[model samples]
Target: MRLPKLLLFIVLFCFVFLSGAQIQAQETNEKADAKQAEPPSSVKELKPVTTIDPLVPLDQLRIMVRPLTKDELQVEANAWFELLRNKSRQIAAARLGVKKTNEAIATNDDQQALDSLKKAESVQHMADEKARQTEEELTKQAQETLGVDVAVDAARPDPAKAEEGTTASTEEKSATTADSTSTPDNPTTTQSAEAMKAAFLQNINRLQDERTALSDRLEVVLTSLAAKGGDVETYRKYIAAVSGLELDTSDASAAWSGIKGWFVSKEGGQRMGWNLGKFLLILFLTWVVARIGSTVISWLLERKVRLTQLAENLISGTIRNVIYLVGFAVALTALEVDMTPVLAAIGATGLVVGLALQGTLSNFASGLMILINRPFDVGDVVTAGGVTGTVKQMNLVSTNFRTFDNQTIHVPNNSIWNGVITNITANKVRRVDLEFCIGYSDDFEQAEQIIRDVLADQELVLREPEAVVVTHALADSSVNIVCRPWAKTTDWWAVKTAVTREVKRRFDQAGISIPFPQQDIHVYSTDASKGNGKIETVSK
Candidate 1:
């Protein structure tokens, strides 16, 4: 050993000396070349060294073919580096082309959005035009049936003797109509004229009342539009549209006064009129009631004596949601809004989505069932759908579990309901099972006593059921000893771990052998071992 060590140190010293000489020779040569170099005016030609052999395998041979100079090696390294850089640039250019194609595809998406916007605008314009035409036809029919033109002509008498002729003519016509009514079977033309005149008079009065109400409503609408800084023509159409509504007001004077001042007042008022105002008020009241109702429900749930955490969550989420939905429906009806269109839209959307996600809907329905039934709560250790873990959270489609090994798993609710659920922590008490084998040469009683002692040492091990040690099986080489101890569910792991450690440690100290499978072989020498039994040629 000493000789080998000395030889290694000698070889290392020679290598260091040769390397140092090479470095010194190179440095001297560089200094001499620098001293002989002329002034910077002349350009020096750079000639690349041609050849340098790469490192060869060390096991081949100890002798080297003339080693290349440093300049030659540097030239070769530069040439190989340039080739690699060129290859990398080519690869980068290919990647850039792919990126440009992706940019073009993204730009094409804007055209789709623009097309949708244009379609929506066109639909809105068409609906507006159709509503306008329908309102105009209704107004025209009401005007033609009411005899409004005849009523207006009758209201004004001739310029000369207007008051005297109006009173006398009205009395004479009434008297004539009353006499003609006595002979009902033979009604004359004058009677018919009087009847027609009375019918026209009643119809004219009704039309005048409708026109007055419409005028007041129009004024209110015009005031609102003007306040909003709408264009003159926009205000005119708004007034005309409202006039067609034929709104009836009890106090015309008060209504017009309210409308005129509403435009000047700081407070926004009668410009919206009673219809819109009542609608907004109903909506606000509904929201407030819903909020208060939700708060009261939360209070009630909190006050309950046997309220579970899950029930509390359900009351706030599910029950409160139902209340809000009903409240909104009631508010919409109170405002006299047509809910049919909205309902139809909602039904169509639901139909499409339900058809698309049949599996997801099934899981959601199963999840609701699980929540209502509550087979297991959070932190319950369960094995379901081929997975074992503690329940972390329950969602609409799936349940999340955090396994003992710290892996997060998502189990579908449908699978949980369809598969077997083994809840280990459902019971308060659990039994620990243990088994060990001892060599046949070891005393059975000693092994049993050791296992019992190990069980007794663990404080978490329960004493009520008592620990048991039995000779479960007898094998060819060993006797199997089975030990059982009862413990609380929470203390199962602690007792199990403590007993296992103590059993191993005490067994080693007591010289008790834990047996494992082994094989034995017998060898016979041809010359020696055959003398005892081979005299009769008997081999067992």
Candidate 2:
């Protein structure tokens, strides 16, 4: 009985211990689950409000603004103004966050402060990205509503002006507030597009003023924070991010007024007039110098160099044009005009023009080659570019040809250069080749002698080289003779015609017949009754 009681007590003690351990394990699991469910204290504490309050999200604002009618744009402009105000607040909040984080770090020397600083920086980065996106969308909207140039000009902030003011002047503040109040609440209200654009521009100006003020405030805060041994680098980066949001407004009328005032002012007008006079004087001097230089070059080329007319003209004209260009550039410099952009533009234009005129350039290059190599010149008879003609004119792009029939042809220099060039009158003398045919029965020796006699009788034919008369070929009907005579290039045609006529006359007198083409045909007929075939031959 004592042993049973002891066993029962042991079992009860073991069961109680096991149940207690189980309960403790359950409580530990619940605690782990609760810890996992909650976000880190640092992350929760530093989560930035990413939205611009009292205005739709940037994406929603884009949708709302995109399809708005011209009259409706004014109403939306108010919302945009409100959006800008909220953005200014957001920037202020971010600035405050940085100050607070810095203050906390200064006061607390612990890991928690470091973690908070890191989280705060992360949050600030996120805020900056959102602000950038919002600014871009607003800029795009403005650009779409107004002309791109006008919007860009209006939005382009003047750094000098921005640096001058930390806060808007009382008058400027009142004007901005007044402009914001002028925007109509009703979307159905009729308003001119111009008026709406003016209002939008006014809002953009307000936004710029607010941003300048914020930047000034941030500058002070950053300076103070830096004095307190806080992280100023992060604040500086924030300032830079905000500075990128340029949304200033400039009045066209004010710009025009200023320009008019400058022109009307005696000192300004006189200075401008003086510059103009200087530019004109420089240009005139340049023109006079260019003229004198060109004349000198022409005289030198003609007298000293004694180049061909084309080469002389090309050189003189090129020098004259270069002089003119240099003079123009000098004139511009005298006027204090920037030449960098001009030169860049000219270089770009030259590249495009060169690409477009590749064939013309090729012709020009070929023409230069022709001039340098002296292949053919004006008045020379040439067989080139598949055309036989006298070269009437030559230029960089093309060569003019006058055919024997008196038809003028314009041949590209490239075409003439790329092919075989036969300059008939390039040399002082040329050879005239003539072929004559005689009957097969006629004596070949007699025909050859006749051709030689004809060539000798022609006064224009050259004798030093001696003429050639030989049996060239024997055809079925005739014997062919080749007569080659050398003569002055100028008298070549006359010599050829005279020799040919004399040879024909001599052949006719000597009874050497120039036979026509002949053929012999044979026909066969079969006699059926006799079983024989009769063959007949006919000559034609």
Candidate 3:
């Protein structure tokens, strides 16, 4: 009985001990697991204290073993012992002897400066490691965040649909507000909802602004095109041409097909055809009108006129230009163009061009004056603008003259209009002024009679003016005489030549001497009184 009781007590003791030991073991395991779940404090520990927050982020820990304070050294020794318990751990550690030597320096009792520098260096290293870890973690998080935002932006709704929806929402909101205002009981609720609606419709206001701007620009472009001769039919034809282009639509059939069909309609074709027909008609009418106008102008110019060739050319040019101008204006009107602005623009351009060509305008005006006044007709010999020549032709800018030497001269009309003009051929008869000189030793009366006889013999010499020869000047060797004779203007040169030749020949025959320039001189030599030198005599 004693043995059995002892055995039962032993079994109960073993069972109780085993159960307590198992419970203790389980508690220890749970504590180890808790520590393993946590992140490291100083990174020297074999396991961390809590699991890290992946989203919050943490960088990898860096550790450096070095000297510590005496108190911290004891803690480090204990920590090393603990590390030994987990000997399988691979971690950097300073030897105890080396740590003690370094810790003595760190305590700095006799070497305080060295110890302070060591402490500062350790602190700085720790701070730098922490900053690097934080920076790395932030970079990783920033990359992930950026990628997410990109995905979100790419998935955002299309702007066109958003604009349409926003517009509809605004209209609904306006209607709802009007309804709410009609019912007074829901005023507060309506105001709150209206504020929310206003916030939501901000994008709608912006879209509407853009749409208004686009519409205004479209109107401007349309007006410009129309003013410059673009029409609805032109637009329709352009659309038709673009639509007829063949496109491979396997990848995008629906969208392109709808676009193509919209432009290739029967209305578009008819519009283009009508425009083409109208263009051809306008062109034909223009040609016919131009031909008829030119013919009429030519006929008018061909009519009898007292004007010269140059004047006739000027008049005909002016008439043809006027006719073409009128025709152009009429054609533009027929084409349904608004000509008011066009005329205004043309007037402005003309004003600018006229100002720029002021000198040319003056020349043209002077040419016109020359044509109208008839100062000298063509084929008349005139002296004007320092030039003596026969008039050839007068153009808008210059007058042409053929000089006696067979040289052609272009004189500006401005000079001709503002200078003296001498028309030598204005009358049927002209004077032939002559001068003659005879020797003082000769008989003046005889020389006079000889000139009169010479003039009387010439057939083309005129007697109406009554040629008179008289003694005009007395000189050292000769007496000068003036001869005046009237002659037909056409035979002036011939008559003058004949009379001069005859008078000289008759004087020679009649013994009326015409002396050359003569001089007489007396000379006395100073040496003649002394009878030392002989005087030289000279004769010619």
- Give the top-scoring candidate (TM-score): 2
What TM-score would every model get versus the actual structure?
0.43, 0.44, 0.41
Indicate the residue-level lDDT of 416 in model 1: 91
**Candidate 3 global TM-score:** 0.41
Residue 283 accuracy (lDDT) in model 2: 87
Supply the global lDDT for candidate 3.
Answer: 0.54
Residue 448 in candidate 2, Cα distance off native in Å: 2.9
Residue-level lDDT for 385 in candidate 1:
74
- The lowest-lDDT stretch of 10 consecutive residues in candidate 2 is 47-56
**Model 3 weakest lDDT span, ten residues long:** 87-96
Instruction: Report the C-alpha lDDT of model 3 over 1-540, residue by residue, as the tens digit.
Output: 999999999999999999999999999999999999764565443321111211121121111112222233333223222222221111011111122223333342423322332343343234333433433343344345334322223564533344345434534544454454444354433342334323322332332233222222222333334444444344323323422223324324323533343344333334345655665666567667666765566566557555665576556666656666775666555544457678789888998999998887888999888888877877889998889999887778888899999999998888888899898987889888887777767789888888988888888888798888889889776788899888887888887888888887898898777776776544556775677755555432
Using lDDT as the measure, which candidate wins? 2
Name the regions of candidate 1 deviating beyond 4 angstroms.
1-316, 320-341, 368-374, 520-540
Query: Each candidate's lDDT (Cα)?
Result: 0.55, 0.62, 0.54
Off by over 4 Å in 3: 1-348, 511-540
Model 2 lDDT, residue 339, Cα: 77
Poorest stretch of ten by lDDT in candidate 1: 47-56
